[model samples]
Target: MRTTTHAAQAGGEPLDVLIVGAGLSGIGAAATLRRRCPDKRFGILEARSAIGGTWDLFRYPGIRSDSDMYTLGYAFRPWTDPQAIADGPAIRAYVADTAREYGIEPHIRFGHKVTKASWSSAEALWTVTAALAGGGERVLRTRFLYLCSGYYSYDEAYRPRFEGEAAFRGRIVHPQFWPGDLDYGGKRVVVVGSGATAVTLVPAMTERAAHVTMLQRSPSYVVSRPAQDRFARRMQRWLPQGLAYAVARWRLIAESIFLYRLARGRPALVKRHLVAQAQRQAGPGVDAAVHFSPSYKPWDQRVCLVPDGDLFQVLRTGRAEIVTDHIARFTERGILLASGRELEADLVVLATGLSLKVLGGAAIEVDGSPLDPAQAMSYKGMMLGDVPNCAMTFGYTNASWTLKADLTAGYVCRLLSWMDRRGLAIAVPRRDRAVASRPFLGFTSGYVQRASRLLPKQGARKPWQVYQNYVMDLLTIRFGRIDDGVMHFGAKGCLP
Candidate 1:
């Protein structure tokens, strides 16, 4: 790996593209750009010292993928590892490998946190200001800026306020920032939240901790599957590696569709099965309805994926327990439940999800006017209305993030190639006056819902509205024409 000393200023003049965040999206974008435009200069700016964003930051026990590795893995690369549901360290290694494989590691500028990006119409360039890790700032000018920084707020950890929280004497930890020195061994632990993080953490912590109690306000649908993909392994043995990857991808996609359909069409059957599974693990006489039943339909809110029923297995072993209750306050020794019950805990883990922020909290402006993302419409779920030569890649809440990200990257490459062929420097998404739409990301999760007002609107027709289906997105983005009505192409000196 090539490491550069932190310079007071950028080494060269304006670059062709400036990518923010060295995570999966940033590295993926760099690989895509290199393939499409070898003559252009581009660099990646990362805030942290490492490449893996979420995977590296999260170190809590059982920090593994909620989605299968087959779907979660990159489309261009085949994951040869046996474990389909990979852990944090393994996933981080894969990310590092990808960066090294594509020669992206040398181009990445670590400890460079982007603070602001301002667009200059006259220069047709973006002036990006970033704060270095050690304490100083540097500015870079680029022809185009791509934000792959994701939507989560890394610095801001979510911890709900309970009355008398200050009175609690025990140690408190947030899974977002797990401390290495803190010991949970032989101590009673209470994990808050019913999300993927909490579910994963509870089982892992129970092994070391004396006892673990998962506390949740509302129940979430949980499904368990094997850690290894049997079909993926079979295909690898029977066919070529490339063909096996393709088959595995299609098989996973088909399975997702069937499962989603089964949940939606035969709600009772799916619900009964889920309840039975929970009961079988929790044992007879336990009321599975209160802890496992959710108010919303399955897939409405993401169903937590447990590998090989590890969570159920933990419950069966009686090392951990689940409690559905509203927290009234924090006592000196434990949490006071709304039912006037006290749950003692030596340590508390707040896995209460994440706070959503758009474009990694970067300000957006258009023609000297501050752009309101809430008012803008999402053009193909990638670009905002009237935003020129820019695209923001966000993944799916239902499926694997790479599924949408890979498609978006391919589409961006196509757009760049088209612009180069026509000698065009700007391509903006034109706002459709007749299109009546809502926020770009429509979801009820507290974090996503809070930012709904700030997100762009989706279109009613194809290409504009994000079709979560991978096959459809592949065709629309890869095979479709560049001169689609939603996107407006312009020459170097032309406006609009």
Candidate 2:
């Protein structure tokens, strides 16, 4: 984490590629490029000091992957862990290990945040301005730019304004920036918001807190599964690690796709099944209908998962409870409900959600003209329309993020290889006016709905649309031809 930065780390020659962010997507891209494009030189610029993005940033109690590690893990790497749902620290260590194993650490430049990018038509290069972590600046030039920074804001999570919050005497905390030394032991804690964070926090805080209460305006669909993956265990015992991982990954991906489709097409049937699963987990003491039943369908937002029914166990033990009502205002002792009731809490955890910040708030310019990322239509969910020699790795919302990221990285290498063979220096998606614009994402979750307007738009037609399906993306990205009619490829100053 060097702070003294006058220039972009002294690169004598222009880099073949410059990847932003050292997280999963960025590291994966570097690994793919290293292997596929062995002759090209590249560097990864990471804003943070460490590797793992969400896993490293979030230190809140009970922070764990909502999805199974088999699917969440990279396609090339085998996840040997028996636990399907892994905790934050373990996941972070896994990412760190992956980086070391793939030799991507050498290409990483930490404490360097890219602030602006200006592409030169004459030079066929992108000159990037990055702010060094401490108090300096650096400039780097590369033929291709890859933005792997995740969509959410790193500086702050979404925090909502509550009435009379200033007068509240209890400590209010957001899970995004969990205090290192804050102690909630033996305290009556209340977790607000019914998303994954609130569900995870309730069970974790129960072991230490005197009493934990989950207060939500409405319920979210939550289903509990065994922490250890039974199939993964059996497969690992019989088959090789890599083969077992690939098999389990495909099975889970298929199951997830089937379930999601069912939820969308036959929402009533899917909703009933989920509700029954919740009731079975709750047993006789707790009411699943009151706590687990959401107004939306199963996949409307994301379905929260509780490993081995930990949340239910805590609730059955009387250490935790759930209350569904709107917050009228914040009282000195606690929060007042819209129903004229008040609940007391010594500590309040705001599991509100995330703030979406696309491209880490970096400014992009092409030929001295400012390029608004939001205005540019997305091309194959990886490349932006009218943006040449640039790719953005955005993963599937329904499945593991790496599934799409790896595919995107592979396609990028393919494109680069093709361009080199043809002596071409640039490739940009030329938008078609006939194509109708659609929302980049269609999820109705609060965070997404709030930030959808700022996100890049997708086209209604093929090659320009982003299908969240892995199979479609595999054919569309991994096996698809690089010379799509929409993409313009040319030598330096040859085509304008």
Candidate 3:
């Protein structure tokens, strides 16, 4: 790793690849790059002082992986823990350990928050600018820019204001920026939103709070699975460690794919099964249809996961309640619902969703022209149409994020290798004007819908389409041809 940070080292001499964000995708990208393109110069620019992006950022109670660890864990690393559904700290440690194991820690530059990147076709390089966490700024250049900063803003969360908030006496908290000194013990807690966060918080807060209520405008589909994978444990007993891990990983992947396909193919059948399962899990009193059954089909938005029916168990205990009603206003003691019901609470948790941020909220330009992501089309769900020498690591919406992130990293490495072999300087995905454009993501989720106009569009065909399937992505991105005619390559001093 380069130790110097002078203007020349920072900006003058260009790196082979510059990765933004040291989170899950960024760390995985670095590890992949080190293995695939060992000799290439690279650096990871992390805005925060530490690694473990999302895991490190969120410190809310019972913060854990919604996806199973077997699939969420990196392709190269084996998640050997007995618990398949690991918590936030464990996942963060796993990521940090992966970086240490791959010798990626040395290449990471902490406190460098990337602000903007200007791509010069003439120089075949990107002039990147980042703000220092302490003070001042630093400029750097790279041949290829890989954005793994994630799709949501870390600086701010999607926190919608409620009427009469100032009149409320209790403290209101957003899960994104959870307070370390918060004391909700013996207090009536109300968690807003029926998303993954709310579900996780409801059961967790019930442990300490007098009572916890999950208040949602609408319900979300919830799936309950064991915390530990019995099959994984059995595999560990029968097979060697590596082989066992591989088996468990593949098993989970296949199961998720099958389940997703089933849900999509037969939404009504899956919906009925989910509702019935929730009803059985929650026991007699709870109305599954009224609280657990989502209006949208499964996988339309992400299905919330509750390990070992934790949420349902809490609901069964009567310590937690799921209320489906709009918030009319914040009352002095609690919240007033649209149904003319009032729920008294001492504390409120806004477990609302995240705000979508494209490219870590960094500005991108090509030939001194700013790139509007909304106008540009996505290429293979990673690169933008007409955007040269750049790739963004966006994961699958339907499956574990790492499943798609790993494939994306591998594809970027392949692209780099292909360019190296051919002595090429630039590679850009040329847009096919004939192809019809569609939304980047196919979800009715509020966050996605809100950011619809800000996101890039996907084409109706392969190479330009963003398939949320891991199998298709693994086949095409990992094994498919690099020079598929869509991605135009150029030699030095030549623009694609």
Candidate 4:
């Protein structure tokens, strides 16, 4: 990858597009641009030295994708691997390999942490400022700016301050910052949170830890599936790699849509199925009602996936346990629950959750006016209101993230091509004053709720509304009209 900050400074000419964050979405955007908008020059700016964003950063034991790889993998590049639920390092390798295969590495500017981006109405260009590695800075101008920085903040994880935390003698760790040299072997570990991270950790750490307890205020829905996709394996044997992968991808996508639709339309039926599955996994004697049940309906928040019923096996083997209770405080030995029960732990893993951030908390300005994402309404869930020549990719909440990301990239390519052909200098979505606004995300998850007010608003109508459905997005993004009434496209000093 290119270590320099910006291409303009190195060559004295601005790029056609500047992509932020060389993670899954950014890399995919580059590949899409290379294919669809080959005439336009683009550069990717990543803060870290590595290519993988989430996969590379999260180094905790048993870190893996919650979504199956078939759906998570890029549409252009099929994942030929057998594993549906792949680990962090494996996924990281897959992403890095994709970058190399597409020849996207050389256009990526590593160690360029974006601080701010400003757009000029007169020039119809964006001036992006980023910090360099050695302590200097670089400024680059571009006609279009695409942000794929991911939704979560990289600086810190969501760690709630526990009462008497300072008094606790045991080592406290957050999964976001897992220590490499620290050993948890033979130690009693108490992991806080009932989310995906907590479930994954409790089972994996059981092999090395003396005992692992998943301590949470309430239970989350957990379902088990095989790690490998047997159907995908069989398809590969009969069909070509690309064709087999497409079939598996679509099959998984259809199943996801079906399940989510069921959860939304008939909550009681899906809830019963989920609870019954948990009951079978927990076995006869254990009280699944007390330990496995969730208060809210399914799909209100994310459901944790356990591969091959591994978490269930660990629970049955008595290597791990789940404690559903409120944390009273952190005691000298361990955590004290509200039930007056004390659970001792030598090491405490706080897998609480992620801290969400919009645009990585970077400053954005348009025509010397400060811009707030919250004040803007989303157009097609990517471009914000009055945000000229900019688009940000945020993936689906219900399905695989890449499903929406791939669609977003393809649409952006179309937008760029249309602009180039028409000789248009700028494009921005104009939110009608008559339209009503709603929360960007419909979910009631803690992280989302906390950041709701800070996030961009979504309208109730098409082009401005947010739908997590991949099929709808596929048709809309891939074939939607470029001159939609709401989107203003024009040359500088011309009618918009």
Instruction: Give the per-residue lDDT digits (tens) of candidate 4, residues 16-87.
Output: 999999998899889988888888899999988889999899999999999899999899999977789999
Q: Pick the candidate with the highest lDDT.
A: 3
CA displacement after TM-score superposition, residue 322 of candidate 4 (Å): 0.4
lDDT of 3: 0.91
Per-model TM against the reference: 0.95, 0.97, 0.98, 0.97
Residue-pair clashes per candidate, as listed? Answer: 1, 0, 0, 0
Q: What tens-digit string does per-residue lDDT give for candidate 2 at 276-352?
A: 88888777777778878888877778888899989888887788988898999999999999999889989999999
Query: By the TM-score metric, which is better: model 2 or model 3?
Result: 3
lDDT of 1 by residue, 37-111 (tens): 777788889999999888888899999999987888888878888999999999889888989988888888898
Ten-residue segment with the worst summed lDDT in candidate 1? 1-10
Q: Candidate 4: lDDT over CA atoms?
A: 0.88
CA RMSD (A), model 4 = 1.8
Error of 1 at 176 (Å): 0.4
On the 0 to 100 scale, the lDDT of residue 286 in model 3 is 95
What ranking of all candidate models by TM-score puts the best one first? Answer: 3, 4, 2, 1
Give candidate 1's TM-score: 0.95
Clashing pairs in 2: none
